[model samples]
Target: MKNQTKMWLLIIISIFSSLIIFIAASFIMGDFGNKGYDIGDLKTISNEVLTTIDQQEKGISSILDAAHAEHPAVHFEWIQADGTAIYNTAGTPQNYDFQQLADHFLSIPYNLWTEGETISLVYKTHLQQQPYYLLMKLPSTAMQPGQVYFFLRTTKVLLTLLLPLIIAFMVPYLLAIWFFSRMNRRIHKLNHALTQVNLQKDIIVLQDTSKDEIGQLTQHYNSMVERIQSQVIEIEQFDNKRKQLLSNLSHDLRTPLTMILGYAETIRNGLYKDDRELQSSAKIILQRSRYMDKLLDQLLDITRQNTHALTLQLAPHNISEMLRKILADYLLFLDGQDYIVDVHIEDTDIMIHIDVALMERAIRNIIDNALRYGKEGHYLGIILKEQQNDVWITIKDKGPGIASAEQERIFERFYRVHQGRQGDGLGIGLSIVQEIVDLHQASIHVTSVPYEETLFQIRLPKKEDELN
Candidate 1:
């Protein structure tokens, strides 16, 4: 059910349960409740007093006096059948102001006015030998017979019956209200937290102190914030990288373009009289053009990688054979150069799912990086290992290893490790490699120590069923 629906359902159930409990407890306790001056009991007492007066032939005053002593809150008056006053306890009039009594009687609704100031009865049987009317006058307190009458008569029984019914109805109702009130406060807190979120600043995570639906909502909100924060950071980094790439492109192109322009102008303006000088100028111009073309190609590669337009041709293939061939190609390219290639493979037929061309390009970048930067060490090692449900390719070099602080930025486009290094290529090979690896759902990590050794490890997932 929806949370709001469930909340209301529970509240309704609590109220219904409280009502049921109140009714059930009241019925169960009724027998034990106070029987305070029941109308029937009062009538029986009055008949007994009348009998006593008839048998003794004593005046009605004596019997009324005794009844009055027994219940001080009540008084008695007798009136003859002919409307003559026989006896009155007050010794004056009936002591109840007729106008005031009539007004009080009229003020109350007829259905609600059960017992009032006077309870009168007429005696016409032979036991009295004459017709008479007995009028009972009750105190102001007993004039209204309600719960208070029972309390004034018997406290214990009345309390026992009332306490449980009152508690049953009120306690659950109050608790349900309290629970919903707490939920309301938490919802408001969540709303405030959401309203206050600012993208320009770090994300704020709301506190989820409860183990309820509200807490779950807060947790999901926090997770969404974390994902957005990560995307924002990635976008900012890409923006910074783009700015740096343009700056480097401008600086790198300036020298070569200047050389090409100056030499061409010299040849065009006939500034070089000697044939040899003219040939030299043309060769320099040609060389600068080639360098510029190569720089443009690298820039294109970076653009393609950053824009995520590289399509992958995924297939299952032997990774070990692929590595060996890649190494062989590198060896041929760097033939006779001061370099060494060492290879290790645990299995020659270990198959993996990959985009062959992209994976090859990724591995080629690592090897090219080793050959270029590790020229001083003159040694490179490639290790391929198959583990349970996974495979790893590690390339190690013993050149002037990267500094600890620069390792994290090594994969950034156009990021040069040594700013003063002699180079004609843009620093985007590793970045492209990282992009391809990410496309394959793979992970790469690098460990390097200055002047010691650098290791780059790439991990890829493998399934035994696919291999079989």
Candidate 2:
């Protein structure tokens, strides 16, 4: 059930429970006070009072006088069977109708009855074994001869005792009701806020100021929304890139295919004048064909990487040795470039698990990029640092460094910082490098200052046993 419903239900039960307890206590105390006088109890008190009065030497008259002196509010008359008043209190009327009072008592359910707006108590007793009736007039029916009755016209006494009882039971009950109501209202407000929130516009927030469990829930929900928003933005960006990629791929492929088709058609039509011209046409066709093949291969590699279908042959190998071997091929290529090479390797040997072939490709791709764009700076440096359980390989070059904004995007498929620069290969070299690095559970990032220097850092984790 809803919290509000449960809270109201609990409050109702508490009030009813308290009321039941109060009524039950009243009944119990009433019985304990002996106010609900049974016939046996009334007979006992009447017998004692009558015996004392009969033993007096002056008879009922002196006894009545003495009782009147002691209790001025008490009034009674001792009536004989013949309706003659043997003894009457001073306040008794001279023509008091005893027959009417006796008849009135017989008609009522209880011995106590009201007479003309006055209330009194009646008891049947015997003086000297002769049957008589003791008729007592009282200020209030509540002030009986031997017991106090709480349920009569005892307003002052009942109010005096009931005021404190009401406060003792009602104060806490009211406070509890207020507390639950306040909580229910706050929760309802929170629920309304949650329902009205629009994630497409902005994150949902609770206006509640208290640092309670609900507040914590709001914080966690906000965090989850933020993560979802970021992922949505990233997916949208990737979608845009994919659209552009298809357009670029078609353009790049069509250029080379058109050239190859034109030259082959010319050769087939024998449009060339001599063998030399024919050979030139054939060589151009072969070069374009090779370029297309290379582009297609890069495309395949990227597709496989994205689909998690790229396989790796994982084995422990010395990372320092791997770097040296990959650089050997680049050293051969840089022979006529007149570039200065600064190579740094820590003396310690570090063994890390990696896919050797893929890692070499990633390294070669980065160095090739450096040599291609950084030729003007004429300085290439390789640094390898072996730490406790990790390896750091940094390649630095003095080149027209990449802009900060383009650093991250350069790793996208077919993305090139300087598209105008002459190049023989597809623009997926860096993208492939990123794919391979990620496959080996490694991280790679680049930082550069324009026209100054660019540093590409790659961190690889080593196995725990190897570190030990």
Best by TM-score: 2
Q: Please, what are the lDDT tens digits per residue for candidate 2 over residues 1-468?
A: 988788878888988997999789977876766353333444554465577776763467777667667656566677766666667786553334766775544534344433333344567766567887776654434333244345646678788888998899889978988987877777776677567655466655555566877667667666666786787787777777677666667777888899999999999999999999999999999999987887788788768767877677788888888888777877887898788999998767767888888888888888878887887899889999977667888998999899888987899876778764333355678888887777777789799975578999998877644323
As a whole number from 0 to 100, the lDDT of residue 450 in candidate 1 is 50
For each candidate in turn, the TM-score is 0.57, 0.61
Candidate 1: C-alpha RMSD after superposition:
12.7
lDDT of each: 0.75, 0.73
Give the range of the ten consecutive residues with the poorest summed lDDT in model 1: 104-113
Q: Write the per-residue lDDT of candidate 1 for residues 1-468, one digit (tens) a residue.
A: 755577778878877886789778976665456434545555776787778777876666878888888877656677665556668776754434455434434433232335434444334323346776666655333433333334356777787888997787678677877887788778877887788777797677888867788899999889988898999998888788678777777878898899999999898999997999999999999988987897898888976866777876678899999998998887887788777777898755898898888898889889878877877888889999998888999998888888889999999877888765434367888988888888777889999865467899999888634422
For model 1, the superposed segments whose C-alpha errors exceed 4 Å read 1-170, 272-283, 315-354, 377-398, 412-416, 419-427, 438-468
Could you tell me the lDDT of residue 39 within candidate 2?
36
Alpha-carbon RMSD, candidate 2: 10.7
The numbered model that scores best in lDDT is 1
In terms of TM-score, how similar is model 1 to the real structure? 0.57
